[model samples]
Target: MADIAHTVHVALGDRAYDILIGDSLLDDAGAILAERFPGRRYGIITDDNVARAQLPRLLKSLDAAGLGHTEIVLPAGEATKSWAYLGQAVEGILAARLERGDLVIALGGGVIGDLAGFAAAIARRGMDFVQMPTSLLAQVDSSVGGKTGINSPHGKNLIGAFHQPRLVLADLSTLDTLDARQFASGYAEVVKYGLIDDEDFFFWLEEHQAEIFAGGPARGEAIARCCAHKARVVIEDEKELGVRALLNLGHTFGHALEKDTGYSDRLLHGEGVAIGMVLAHGFSARLGLAPSQDSGRIAQHLKKSGLPTTLADIPGKLGSTETLMAAIAQDKKVSRGALTFILTRGIGQAFIEKNVDGAAVAEFLNEMRALPLSP
Candidate 1:
């Protein structure tokens, strides 16, 4: 086995798995899979971007181990996480003749992970799958949790299932190919773990943001810590019933913005979350629940990391407040037509608030829309 830098075990009893974070995990994947899943065939699901950049390393490893597998490469982007692509992934698995015991490997960023995992979940009445997350965002967040799904016309991730992976291999080397914007986008999620409840981690990030960005020791450490934190949450609330909602601290606003942007290159997922997190903090402050300065601090950190921290940072015209409110209403966090949000008391102090007034949210959004665009 190549030296693994970090390993976080997700303890879910029968559904338990480990998230392995290190370099060359993809190169060793075939040997790893052969030992763990002997006599099982494999279907590899990935995106065109990942396939071009990293698939050969994986295929070479698999071939060396004499493992049998088929590859399905989809178009790369948020829009690829749709019903049409979901169908393509599922049909590809079926056409590959991968049986129930065979595993589906989600070998890309968040979009491929969700699409392939969802495909594995229903392909043969729930076949097991592995997460081979290539992007920094996927390595830290989406690849750890069992929540896998495609986007809906109604909202983001509205149609999906909580199908845990058999294992997660987060190869650090894969991130080397990412552009500055993509890497910065992923960093937004890294900041989120600290924002959720680890004030110390956030402070540490502030101290070492440059090191992390420059791909030093802090980068691996940050990814491992985020994975470990998420593993604990998934173990505690596998289906997002309670504390798991805290993970969506900025996602409500983020998803709405994504829908508004039509899930295109106009705004990346991490970019939306960066802006959403600021909005979440700003909204909390508006309610007199948190210190106003906290939002500004977060915005400063995100902006330094090359992320957009305000609505004005988004290019082009935004939807009306009513349009945004409509998207928020369709959020999965809603309960019986009542709004629910993850609000904060301050840095590292977040809590879920149910039965939030829609009018209050609408009013805050109206005020936000009136602010001058960020220069």
Candidate 2:
């Protein structure tokens, strides 16, 4: 594989890091990990699926670097991001006698990354970890940011902490094994970077959609750009006190939908975000804040990318507006009894509005469900 040189600097006060993007980054992980965590024993946490496909290469790299390492493979999927599995991961790390200075290598998609990273954060009152993101979703979004957590019965990612990784190695080659649905789901987040701040990148993605979906060099570039955008936001606001909220443009709505539907495999995180982004845009349009055409275009783009873009794509039956409204009311974004929504005026522009009326939002969501699918 040819090396593609690209670097994005994440400036987080004194604890900053750089996101390196290339084709054979996994092959270079030994050097990168060694540089950040010299002489530290490492423990790898991964899922069964990823362990089967990518662990051998990672193990070989770790072996070459002469790092003492052990691995714990958990079940794949969102289900694994639970208290039990989190406990199991911590046990595995402890069983390996990993200390505070030792590193935890998260070698799967978001689930493994979140689970392992959170354990690292709490294991010894904060230990270092590295992200070896295999899925596009992890590469573009989760891996770059230090936000790590497990899920609660109430919501996804409800039980986590802000734990930054010592290094993030996003090997594009791993994406080749991702199924089409998973690939498309991850692309929703790639589009999000452009939707929130960089309009040009969004248009660039529109132009190169085919190549991106086909997993060419353009796909790696897109992933890098998205990660860069996220890294910039996280570095500036590591605790999400301000600017980082923009990154959750669709997450509020997406999370609500996920909770209402019971967080099943039927609704992947990115797919929910795809539909949520459209709905958010539509809500902005309904409030006379954005053009309806822009909302339609966003929805159309997601559909073209093979992602769900409407309420219909959500698995469960469309319950009453009251149910959806209740979910929104409990969202973490809400503050002081007001529902704060992330609304977009257009592509590359998004703002958080706390003055939004719950009644009005409920009515709008009800109306959205009534609309017919695009022809």
Candidate 3:
């Protein structure tokens, strides 16, 4: 409470919830939940990495509040966001006797949030859950919208439901534990909000990225801004019927890359996004949809922040052009078997395009493989 925090309201009328951002909120998690869902016991779902660094503190807080709780710690990594572990989480919740009125707290990164939220969705038809996002990517994006699910062997987040959380507690202090790579990966998403539509925010980030990296107050401001943007978009288009689809600017390309890498630590979600965004802008430029300078600047910023901006930067073989194209073809955004992409006119000016020429995309990918990615 003391550290200058902010709350962004996701206006969903009866389903409305506030995204609380700050430090010490984790210690106050139980009280917050008690206020929101009185007399509800909690089932905490987390990954091992988060449990080691963050779970102890959260458990201590819940105990201090005298609230009863149980937790299931899954092996950490993107691999955990699958059907096998979804079953494990559901079984753990049932084992803890979590009823429909009970609460499930997702206390990890995006993977845990998606998996746990999906578990709550199918458990007894539906149940309320809270989001305690620890990673930068989760706090800024995945934890906000009700987009919960696991990766499909065919594509990322191909299997999931639209189940919103009752609340989202994004404790900025939790980010302090993230390694440099994780932090930068999250920043990629932060930059995404700007690239989606906010020209001013993108420029602001260009100037203040160092401060954000240093975990200065600007970091909180940046997170709040990103959350506000997401809340606004979700409010306008709860489903991906229209404007909300703009949010997936880099996801189509990113998902293909993720599938190629087997969704391993070899390429974190945000890292794939970093490269995808560069490719997105690069492709947009190649097709005369956007300016190359805009693409170059974004690539340079991502590179300066220590994220990969090219397929060459990713480790291991990414397979043939057709292999990657097949992955994109399976993207959920595809309609009538035609590819859909979120392209851009420039930074902060992204838009959706249906039935994108598949051959043109393949050519762009082929050219990207050979050209220097610096610009």
Candidate 4:
């Protein structure tokens, strides 16, 4: 039974699926899939990191249930989400002779989910896949959204497709293998849901932050809450056509930082997002749209969670404002060559702004680079 704690259903008619959040779901995945999917075989696509830590458990479950499967282990990290790896994943499925009716199981963090799902989307002209997300970031955000893709040299997620998974299995136990920094990085996304449009959830996160880190009951609840909120938004805007854009509160600035950092460990995706969220709020305040105090408070919470909440927190050197602007220009949100950003009036009040002045953003970046750290 895998102690199923929470299940959030994404009501997308024929493309619909459920996100199962619970303890040890990985150990029960074989049984669950066998019952739900029947005779279909599975191609388990994972990263090197997850293969070492969690692959055995999954294989064991599948073996116990007499289910046939193939494993493709790619290198870990953001760089893996590229054309080379995408081809490798797609080829792996093809070589395994996995038919369109078979399934591709994305069994890792955001990187694996994106790469594998994107591969499934193109392999044999679109195959069904399942998200068995193992990282906190993937479980709460990337895994549920169905926004599968690979990154390009121009910017993040520049090449991709919206291929919803057949199901999502987020096992809480897998988080135990994450180091403090990795866990904290993922927590940044957890905080993002509240910043998007759920002030009450944000407050709850503040109170339960420590408990979540400690792997208390609040951890499961928080994951489920974030999933439910995202599921609702996905239903309303499956393709990021409107309200779903709110889910990218800090992604505009964050993606630029990621490209600037070369997607290295120096700046994790969530770390960039943490700093980006602070920048978003600060930028709003500078424009007289949100109070300055709100940015400070958000920064404080993120910092306390062990995340970098400012440009200065990035190690070594950073790209110039012009460089960042160039990256932002290449962002997916750009429409008709106009910059689009998710700006906020306060916590939980994010809105899509398509006509943001590029000059103001450039000036803000320059100023942010010079500003002293808050005391």
Candidate 5:
């Protein structure tokens, strides 16, 4: 384990927790788990993909801690976030005779985290769960917030609860197993913090793209910074009431894109978010809320990072402005017949605008389709 130590504190009164980031964190899981959860038994929920590559290390750590545990492996991907699977996970916990005081260990990417956390939230009316996020996207975003739940046909994360984890173990070393596409996808969210309220971080990422992409100390620092920003927001608003809404910068448009694409493997969540952020910037520019150059710069950086910055890049996906508009209408952020969008004036400056004109947003999407692919 490297001597790199980074911790972000999420202040939510009694519900608060720390997000710990470092290399070989999986190796230190024993100590971290023991410190956070002094219980005897734990239920580990992971997917087959993660189990094959990373579960052994986590299991070894649990054994070292002398913590009794049972592992349940589910199928990999978005499809696993269904009611049936969630029920099965709860049953697994019951079968293992887990108590409310015992911990449920989520040891995978967002899918596993969401399903396992949701299971923990409802099982026995809420049991403790630890987030051992292995994916880059999960490490910086999903793992910190206690936003746990499964998805329904209506929308992604529709059936969920705000069940914060007891502790978040972000092992940066797990990212080594990520493929190029997955790595680039996770970088999309990393870029989001800059788009929201850290212009300096945005420029820093632009300048250090090479090192960050190459996986070094610079990348670790960037991931920790992003996680810290998210933790602060989550702490302020445990639910999506006020400041927390800002964290969904690219998520509104990104979620629509994901649903329109049928949530298939063709489009990963991070890839959709990458394109959505560009669209959001463009929409902000169209409304005269943000500088057009900023949108262009963001698109350029996403391209440089090997993430898609254009709608067309997502093959067989919805291209019609009308379809996109319909999906946007179904967005969870919409309230009382009005649409709210998280727009930015510049990097590091974002605000929400309510009662946005849907027609104008449609026009912006149309224009984006006509424009040449951003480089």
Candidate 6:
């Protein structure tokens, strides 16, 4: 754990919040919260898996600060972000007797953060909450954005809210316990920040992949960097009405794959994002927006990092190109029945492409589906 931490403020006027990054953040959670929240009892919402890994340190901090808290620990994984569990969580928080002035602590990966954050949004007509994201995915992306929701029968994150957290606490040390695949899955989001707008960051990630993987100074730096990028975007467009949509560069395609695969371990969210990013680049090339070699470079980098970069790389059936196209039509980015995608001129030059021809997207899906899986 690093001795000192870095802070990135999401400037939202009265709705502003700070994302505290680096190692040993959990160690300071007590003091940080005591000062900011003041005399509040937090109702923690975590999953079983995250509880085993992160709860002890957080609990120790709360105990050290003499802070009181209630808890709702659900089952782990994407499954936990369902309507059933969401209802359960809301009921549990109410049972804990939290009021509008009270706060909730989302203490896990994207699953817990989304579920709990959404719970905070609807419960008691919206309660203030804090983010204590425990996974690399949460630390870099999901935890900061305040896009809380659960997957719906028709599509991923079809049900969600734009309820922002009061603060975000990302303890980079928590990544040390993540399995290799989980860590790599998160690395996709880190690469996303670079691919979206910062070419130098992408090149730097390419050069220091090893250091980024190895838990140390570089890891903290990488996490902080991603958070900084996300913080800037959130500040610029707290809602997805403008530049904020740039953050979904690969998500339009990624969410379709996730829905097809049932949002299980068969295709983790970040894994889907990795493949989606490659597809985003490949589709951009198909549209003559980016060079073919540029797409190939992106694919090769993801493959080298043990990430799946193609539809064929997916473990199970992903239906057909038509099915994929159907799922894509349901993308939240669609406007007035026209598809919108964040296509790129190249790496670091992503742009919002509104009213992209649906026929062309279908053709692109067909081509991606026809391609052989990369090894």
The lDDT per prediction is 0.93, 0.86, 0.90, 0.93, 0.87, 0.88
The residue pairs that clash in candidate 2, if any, are 149-160
Score candidate 3 by lDDT: 0.90
Residue 161 shift from truth in candidate 5, angstroms: 0.2
How many Å off is the CA of 6 in candidate 1?
A: 0.2
Best-to-worst lDDT order: 4, 1, 3, 6, 5, 2
TM-score (C-alpha) between model 2 and the true structure: 0.96
Pairs of residues at least 3 apart in sequence or in different chains that clash in candidate 6: none
What tens-digit string does per-residue lDDT give for candidate 6 at 27-88? 88888889888999999999988888889888899889889989899999898888999999
lDDT of 5 by residue, 239-316 (tens): 888888888888888988898888887789999899889888888888888888987889889998898888878776
**What TM-score quantifies how close candidate 3 is to the native fold?**
0.98
Residue-wise C-alpha lDDT for candidate 3, range 1-375, written one tens digit per residue: 224398999989888998999877898886777677778889999999999999998999888777889989999988898889999999999988989999899999998999999999988898999999999999999999899999877788889889889999999999999999999999999999999999999999999999999999999999999999999999999878999999998999998888888888899899999999989998999888798899889988999999999888888777789999999998888999889999999999999999799999999899777765454
TM per candidate: 0.99, 0.96, 0.98, 0.99, 0.97, 0.97
lDDT of 5: 0.87
lDDT of 4 by residue, 29-110 (tens): 9999999999999999999999999999999999999899999999998889999999999999999999989999999999
The alpha-carbon lDDT assigned to residue 366 of candidate 6 equals: 83
Between candidates 4 and 5, which one is better according to TM-score? 4
Candidate 5: segments with Cα more than 4 A from true spot:
1-4, 317-319
Clashes of 1: 0
Off by over 4 Å in 2: 1-4
Runs in model 4 with CA error above 4 Å?
373-375
Q: Which ten residues in a row have the lowest lDDT in candidate 6?
A: 1-10
Best by lDDT: 4
Question: TM-score of predicted model 1?
Answer: 0.99
Q: Please count the clashing residue pairs in each candidate, in the order shown.
A: 0, 1, 0, 0, 2, 0
| Clash pairs (backbone) in predicted model 1 | none
Error of 3 at 73 (Å): 0.8
